[model samples]
Target: MTLAPAPKPAVAPPSPHPRRWAGLAVLSASLLLVVMDMTILNVALPAVSADLRPGAVELLWMVDVYSLVVSGLLVTVSALGDRWGRKRTLLTGFTIFGLASTAVLWAGSPGEVIAVRALLGVGGAMIMPSTLSMIRTLFTDARERATALGVWSAMASLGAALGPILGGLLLEHFSWHAAFLVNVPVMVVAIVAGLLLLPESRNPAPGRWDAFGTVLSIAGMVALVYSIKQFGKEGAAGPGPWIALAVAAVTLTWFVRRCLGRPDPLLEVRLFRSRPFTAGTLVAVTTSIAMAAVMLLMAQWMQLVQGHSPLETGMRLLPTALGALLMSPPAPWLAARFGTRPVLAGGLAVSGLGLGLLPAVPATYPWIALSLFLLGLGMGSLAIASVAIMAGTPPQKAGSAAAIEETSYELGGALGVAVLGSLAAVVYRGALPPAPAGGGLPGPAADAVRESLGGALEVARQAGAAGAELARQAKAAFTTSLEVTGLAGGLLMLAAALAVWWLVPRDLDVTASHH
Candidate 1:
């Protein structure tokens, strides 16, 4: 028999775009816009409340509907990006975001504002995943990609802290409309930059885009998020929430099964079969949950208990952002020197340590500063997780991988607010003094007082001495609840760290995509 030469191993194609770093800047900037939008409402809500005079339900919808729509549409948009083109999808998103934000100038009612936010969510859903997938295609080398993700992560951390500060600054001199107006200009610039610099990429073998699968994913995610939000607000007593939860479970399970049965799935969930991808996703989810819970409670503590101004609270939050900025770039270098498994597990442990210390702090600047720094430092692992997810995924499937990672974050954040917040609520209700039905307060007011610390304070202000005493008890109860939330979050982080360590391969290469 004639000897046949063995085929040479396949090598990754050289990046088609030379202006990689510049493209990264565009991606990072786009990501910053998306992350900031999630939080910018915090300070603007009071302004909106004053201007719109919305009913309580209307106000809640205005605050929450954006996220609900974003989470709901992420999977669908990401899948479409794979079929059409990531660059094309992203630029379209920029156009929509800019137009929607600019249109906010005409918003005259709470319903109109809610519609605007939902439109913004549509743009966000399109933009967010494209950013990550574009990064995957832009940076061909692993180490360079890690560095890029470091910058991406820093921007995310910075954006969260920046939102309140920016809102406060604008609301100082301008109307609430300025908040949305800011996005318009920035998004316009991003859209133009993206068109000039970003290269088109798509799945070379993308199959039929199933509308039914898209519907299932969107419905499941929206229902699940809404169910969680309602449960957090009112606890688990309503049939509406129960029905939504059931629908979400059934719909998501069916969707997953459909993907598994397909030759070219809507999402390449089989990627999770690789332990590294699975570990990275779990880490993403865990960090998001921990950070969300911590940020919410800490912000409340600063404003309500410590009596800090909005500007002062934002300034106090700088340490956390600073720590993330300082540590993120170096994380990739550290992981390369050490092993990926060690770095990931150790980072989570350090974060858990911070959570453990939070409840014991004296609510002073120095004490809170230490915990926040630790939390940010430990968050360094998130960059590593991003690297792992992208590196492990095929370049063609970047959209699916990006969608999965972002979904983890979105769901994690929502659950964090729901589950941990609920746990804190339970502790608060239990520790609070019993609200007698007819003792110096009306039934409606008493029920309101029991609902939240903010409500308690409002009632106290109206009731004078009686309210003052109730407020005192309420603060004490809130503090106790904070303790429970912190401690429980710490335990969960520790558990996640341990689980990741055990599941991740000891010699796993975070940079190279083996699986």
Candidate 2:
């Protein structure tokens, strides 16, 4: 008798462990340090410039090199972690990051500082991918995974908001070096806790490292980001900037072609064929661009024009941090009940509305807090929803998917600063009349004149009443330029919302699985 096939072995649900939560805490803390560093230095840039005395070109490099390096290496380092053990790579990254922070703290010149920051980026590239990849290994249940991701997203948002505040406090009490030194203590704790709590996990069928792909990816990103940086400083239509951009396009095209032909590729290009993955990536990219530009422009407005201290600026931004924190807990439940499409579309539209109000900000506006709160709420909802879609992808492809999401986020930020910043620059330039005959000023004061109306006023204030008229004109011009930039950002965010509505699917889970 054909024996009834042995009853299929019962599949057991993954066992929940208390230690997993501890591991998450350790990972989140490490991630927070990296996120904090990105913005903390913005407040410290002037100090750094004074101490190092870097030239104009060197100053820009010192500020941007870290992000450029990090953006270039993320995919390569992520692929490395998938092949090697993610836990092992993460621990190594933490150790390197600590050492690099120490190097940055002791740096004597602009070149030295730039080198150390770039090293930090290399370490960060290793750390970033491991955090998300580890979550996949630790939590197998969908609901639990979503909850953990929500917490992770909140920590990232909080770290970003807290960076300037933390930097300001350190700068007030100590030297500029304090910013880099601060990471050492945090890294020590992370390394110790991570070693004890984090479990080792690696891909079962991880392919060999693709060295050519690595080179191509790095070359393409650096070229593209560098070109954009040049365009912002110059103009996109400039011949030199166009040449750099063309080189970037060629390198990226080569990289894509290489990936398509490889039996085992560094990045899986096939994943983009999935509608959910593609749409989620687009949303992540566009939202990040819009948000980053707004934050940079608003921070400059608050500090340079409104004359708020860093701490005061951060306090004013509490609406954003609190909004994100409050919205995170309910994201998973909302997505499950209402579907990702509605949530993403609604979140983007709400964020657009919030941004739209900024252009109308009155000199005596009392509703600043409320308007910012709305913006924060919308950003929080969109961030959580986009991340959920990304994380829901299949396990085997998780590393590549995470890399794509991160690449889009970082690239978008770079582009935002480049494109939107250029718009602001143009308006600012046009608002100012050319300097009068015999109005020649020294380079430092001249730069101050170019940056803000307050700087111009301060110059005029020191120069006496003869310069008062020029200062008034500068103030009016600067205010008008800021207004124009704010309106442009709002319109861009609205456009992004429409893009999301058209592209993202109604059901993330089904789309993820099918695609």
Candidate 3:
């Protein structure tokens, strides 16, 4: 047969993207800004409220609408990014974010500001998933991808920690509008850099867009988040929250069923079938719940109880970020040696121990620092969580994985604040001392003391010497509340650790291609 057909030439594996690291920098910076925007608004709200003079309902809407919109839009936007193109979607998101933030100057009313915040949410949803998916696209090597994700996770934690500090500094000198304005320059830089550095990526065979699935996702997510807010605020005081819950349950179930049935689902519901994906998601959700709630309570304790400034509170919280920063870069290497199973499970356990230590130690600044450092150290697991998730998922489904991970974060935060916050409120109310035998405080004032520590502090201030006892007791009760809540959070983290230990396979390899 003539020379036995020349030996087939070998085909080389595709080389990693040339500009991947540069692209990651742009992506990480953009992500930091978006995440920081979420918390910065919290610091700006009091000033905005003073100037806008919004009604109780209007203020609630202004605060809640941004997250509601973000939760509602993430699934739909992520699916669209997979079809349209991640780079184009991300750049467009930068434009929307810039324009929306700039529009804050003209937003005179509470409604206008709410609309502006909602627009920012839209941009956030677009930018968030695109960054993750693009990372997946750029880093073809598993080890490199894990390292990149470590950087990504570190940036996210840093952003959350930095938001309040930045907001406080801006508000110290500038108007509340400065909080919104700060985003503009960042967006401008992101858009220009993104265009130059980022590569276009899309699912090569992305199937038909799911219009009906989009509607279901939006309706389910909005209803679900709104229901959580209502229960947290009113606590079964009304039937409205229950009705929304019912709607959420039904629509979400329908959405999940639809996703599972469709070959080209709007969201990759089937990704949950992968054990590593499932374990990663569980870790993300559970850890977020504890971390978000604990951080929130600690911030309040610092400001209202310890009499620290907002900026001071933010700076104190830096230990958590510092811990994460110190540990994150080396997390992948640790996982490679120790195996992903121990790293993921041990991280949660260490975090739980941090919270557990909070209750055991004296509630002083130094003690809090020690606890926070350990907690941040535990947060380093987030990088491994990302590895497990993406490693288990196919390339085409990266957007879906990112969306699921993000949704877990958003939902977990809402749940933590709702559930754990309510628990703290109950403890605070219970721990408040009764009115003096002489009825040192009026009935309404006493009731207000029972309502919240901040309210009690105000009542204390106005009552002068009579209020001094009340203020001291209120602070003590709040400290007790934090301890109880911290314990509960610790327990939750421990439970999650136990679950993760069982869920993740013993021989799991982050570097392997699961798909």
Per-residue lDDT tens digits for candidate 3, residues 1-515, read 55777888787656789999999999999999998888888889999999999998999999889889889999998999999999999999999999999999999999999999999989998998889989988998898999999999999999999999998899889999999999999999999999899989999999999899999999999999999988888898899999999999999999999998989999999999888899899988988889888998999999999999888888999999999898888999999898999999999988898988877999999999999989999998767998898887777899999999989988998888888888999999887755532366778888888888888899889987777777888899999999998899889988998888899999988965432
| All candidates: TM-score | 0.95, 0.92, 0.98
Q: Is candidate 2 or candidate 3 better by lDDT?
A: 3
Clashes within 3 Å, all models in order = 0, 0, 0
Quantify all predictions' global Cα lDDT against the true fold.
0.86, 0.77, 0.90
- Model 3 C-alpha RMSD vs. true structure (Å) is 1.4
User: How accurate locally is residue 200 in candidate 3, as Cα lDDT from 0 to 100?
Assistant: 94
Ranking by TM-score: 3, 1, 2
**Pairs in steric clash, model 2:** none
Give lDDT: candidate 3, residue 64: 89
Q: Give per-residue CA lDDT, model 1, range 293-371, as digits (tens).
A: 8788888877887788766777888787887888888888888888889888888888888888877877567977888
**Which run of 10 residues does model 1 get worst, by summed lDDT?**
432-441
Of candidate 3, the 10-residue stretch with the lowest lDDT total is 432-441
From the highest lDDT down, the ranking of the candidates is 3, 1, 2
* Cα-based lDDT at residue 385, candidate 2: 53
